[model samples]
Target: MSEVKKIATRDSYGNALVELGKEHDDVVVLDADLAAATKTGTFKKAFPERHIDCGIAECDMMGIAAGIATTGRVPFASSFAMFAAGRAFEQVRNSIGYPHLNVKIGATHAGISVGEDGATHQCNEDIALMRTIPGMVVINPSDDVEAKAAVKAAYEHNGPVYLRFGRLAAPVINDRPDYKFELGKGVILREGKDLTIIATGLMVSEALEAAETLAAGGIEAKVINIHTIKPLDEELVVTAARETGKVVTVEEHSVIGGLGSAVCDALCAKAPVPVLKIGVQDVFGESGPAVKLLEKYGLTAAGICKSVKEWY
Candidate 1:
């Protein structure tokens, strides 16, 4: 196996925002002090006049973005996931979500992959918090290419959008010469009949690798990448469940209310099957190397393969 190039999704979000600024003058960016960390600094450097620094106030930033959206201008508000989604929960729920404003919340440093930040900074519940709000489009792209495409999609779509990005560099799985992204649709990367592996965000690549290992063990596993989490592609999920008769969900978030729970909710309503959720087991992350944390939490390809073996 050859080495694959890796890039953080936050980098893609920043570059994409800059491109959007060049194309659409109405596009504006706002950051709550951590522009460089969130990678919104790339857009700020390109469009200083359009960029607004809201200081360290995450709630104020959300409100300002909501206000900006009312004037028919698109605002991309960025901050760490813990502050943006967790701290500004009330403001986001009322100010932006209630009105369904055209504000894009670019939440960086999501999941336990935020090394050295520990549980205080690592956010594993942003998806659960954001998805609970009505009319909010939730997207967690898997890699650099998908992240860039997701930024463009969020800008085009009206209403509130929560774009979850991570700090760790992820393998470029969707780096195809001709790769197109469709909103609210799940892409089937590999087809199999024994079981289905549905994953979102960084877990997509892990799921793919797990599929390869499972194939070696004579267990054919279908791999599906679900970037859009809120309005999940029910048809594809149901079809996969119906065909495979067994399912496994993988995510970088907690197993409670993230992708795993969302998959179970969809499957339980339509096709009942034995489902396994692979993610943070309802525990806070501690300070450690990101790779080691993933391995400890059983979020790697080997861990996924082990879970499959146990299930079978």
Candidate 2:
């Protein structure tokens, strides 16, 4: 087999922004003094006129992005997850979400995988916060290909959107030419009859790896990649719940209001199957290496496999 590719989703978001800027003149990029870290510097280098650095004021960036959106320009406000989703939440709600403006929030360094940045910098609740906005479309892409496609889709979409990105260099799982990304649709990566493993963001690849381990023990597991957290593919989730009778949700975010909660919510009213949530258990993050943090937080492939087995 060929060597697997590994790239950060934030890098993919930056490259996608550059490509979008080249194709659309109305595309504008804004960052809160984190151009290099958030990777919006790529767009700034490619299209300096369209990219704007808003200093360290994340709330001000949201307001400026909203103002630019009012003029019919597609503005992507890039910032760390803590600043974008936590600090500027009010601006995002009133300025963009309430008015239904065309603004895309590229939130990078999300979740505990932000590592040594510690608890304050590592935002594990961005998905929950974004999902609360009425008109905001929440998207958490699994890999580079999905992240690129999600950026284009968000641009084509004509409303408020929150694109969650990660800093860790995760494995490129959707590198196949046949992979196509559609907003609000879950991709079934592997099929099985015993149980279903639903995952998003960096945890999607981990779920795939766990599925392989489970298969070796004569436990066939289905893996579903839920890139879109809001406007969730309810049909697929309900079908999987009913077919498998057991569901497991894995994510790099908090299990409280992230993918796991969303999955349980979808199934609670419909299929009502036994669901196990595999993520941070409503706890704050700590300083550690990305890989070590994942293992400690029960976000590894082995951890996922163990959780599934225990719940099974």
Candidate 3:
């Protein structure tokens, strides 16, 4: 069997920016002294005149991005998720989100996959923070193809967008020809009638693996990948919930206000069903290998299968 290709979503973000820059002269990139980490440095290398390094001040970078948007220039402010979403919350909520500007926030190194960077750098709450800002489009791409497509989509959209990327290199699962990237659509990867596994970001791939494991045990599992978390493809989620009857949400973020919470919110209002949220259990992450952390937090495919079997 051929080995599966893997590429970090952060790398995809940078490569996509370079392509967008070549196509559109109005596209500019700003970084809070984290171009290398956020992979915006690739854009910097390609378009030195367009890339702006705003030092370590994430808040100031947000304001600058907002100002640039007023001039009809689409600016992607790049930084770590911790500073971009957490530290610059006020600026992002007021400057960019309030006015509803065409500014994209490229937040890389999100979730516990940040590895040895520990809890301070691992931003498991960024999705929740971005989701709270009214009119902010929150997107967490699953793999390389999806992440690149999301960057172009965010540029085309005419409002504040928060694009979440990860430090971990994820498996490329959406390389098939049938795959499509819609701004607010969910893709059903596998069809089954027993239960539904709705996942976002890196967990989407893991959900597919868990589905395979469950299938081996004669338990059919439907898997849905939700790339756009803000609009949340509620129709798909509701339809899947009604069909499968049971729902399990998986994500690399905290269970408090991330994908799991969003799924529950939708299901509660529309299709109420038994739900099992698999993610960070509302605790801070510690310094460790990314794989070990995921294993410990029960974010792996085995962990997911174990949780499902125990609950189901």
Q: What's model 3's lDDT at 72?
A: 97
| lDDT (tens digit, per residue) of candidate 1 on 52-105 | 999999999999999999999999999999999999999999999999999999
Q: Of the candidates shown, which would achieve the greatest lDDT relative to the real structure?
A: 3
User: What's the lDDT for residue 17 in model 3?
Assistant: 98
Look at candidate 2 and tell me the lDDT of residue 9. Answer: 96
C-alpha local distance difference test of each model: 0.94, 0.95, 0.96
Candidate 1 clashing pairs?
none
Q: List clash counts for every candidate, in order.
A: 0, 0, 0
Cα displacement (angstroms), candidate 3, residue 239, comes to: 0.6
Residues 1-312 of candidate 3 have per-residue lDDT tens digits of: 999999999999999999999999999999999888999999999999999999999999999999999999999999999999999999999999999999999999999999999989999999999999999999999999999999999999999999999999999999988878999999999999999999999999999999999999989999999999998999999999999999999999999999999999999999999999999999999899999999999999999999999999
**Clashing residue pairs, backbone N/CA/C < 3 A, model 2:** none
- Candidate 1 stretches with Cα past 4 Å from truth are none
Candidate 2 lDDT by residue in tens digits, 63-164: 999999989999999999999999999999999999999999999999999999999999999999999999889999989999999999999999999999
Instruction: Tell me the TM-score of each prediction against the true structure.
Output: 0.99, 0.99, 0.99
Candidate 1 Cα lDDT to native: 0.94
